[model samples]
Target: MDETRQWTAEAARAAAGKKGEETVVLDVGDLFGITDAFVITSASNVRLVRTIVEEVDRRVKAVGGPAPYRVEGTDDARWVLMDYGDFVVHVFLEEARRYYDLERLWADAPRLEWDEHDGRAVATRP
Candidate 1:
């Protein structure tokens, strides 16, 4: 299995645990040398959004992935950002995600196709 794929899968699983919606993995390898992917998802409520953030943090640590460089938005939890060096995961309440619209902002980045066989995601240009 590929490292990128594994990373993406871990992200998806974490998002699912918190009932994340419209989860997307963006390949930003070409744009940012610091990270390979961006796993984005939104929850319906602030609590669920925070839960999604913690779940992603926990799962990534369980896999021995590097800890996030920083985390923000705990108090309100409308939008939580986890900044891991290779992959940044964003957990947000639905309305907040819509307001930020990261996917649309980074529309040029390639969307990853999940390989359900092994719970991995293969990068591909849109």
Candidate 2:
């Protein structure tokens, strides 16, 4: 897998470990150059959103990744975003996920299949 997709899987696994639900990774490589992929996930509530966000941040750092270039929405924790140079991570509450509907917004982009096991992640394009 490419580096962008690999980091995306790692981020997704970390979010899943924190019980983040409806985890998804969207390949926006064709449409944008600022980043190669997006790792999106939903949490049941605000606290979980914070937890998932922190864990994902830590997981990426644990693997020697630089800190996020930018982050937003942590104050309310309703919808948090962490932007890594090659990929971005989004942790949101269910309602926010539904309302924003990023998956549908980028429906044309291919969805990447991913699985988390043994504290690691594996992924492939559909």
Q: Record all residue pairs in model 2 with backbone atoms less than 3 Å apart, i.e. clashing.
A: none
Error of 1 at 5 (Å): 3.6
- Name the candidate that leads on lDDT: 2
- Evaluate model 1: give its lDDT: 0.81
TM-score of 1: 0.88
| Tens digits of lDDT, candidate 2, 1-126 | 365666788789899889999898888878777787889999999999999998998988887676999999999999999999888898999999999999888777777776675333343444
lDDT (C-alpha, whole model) for all candidates = 0.81, 0.84
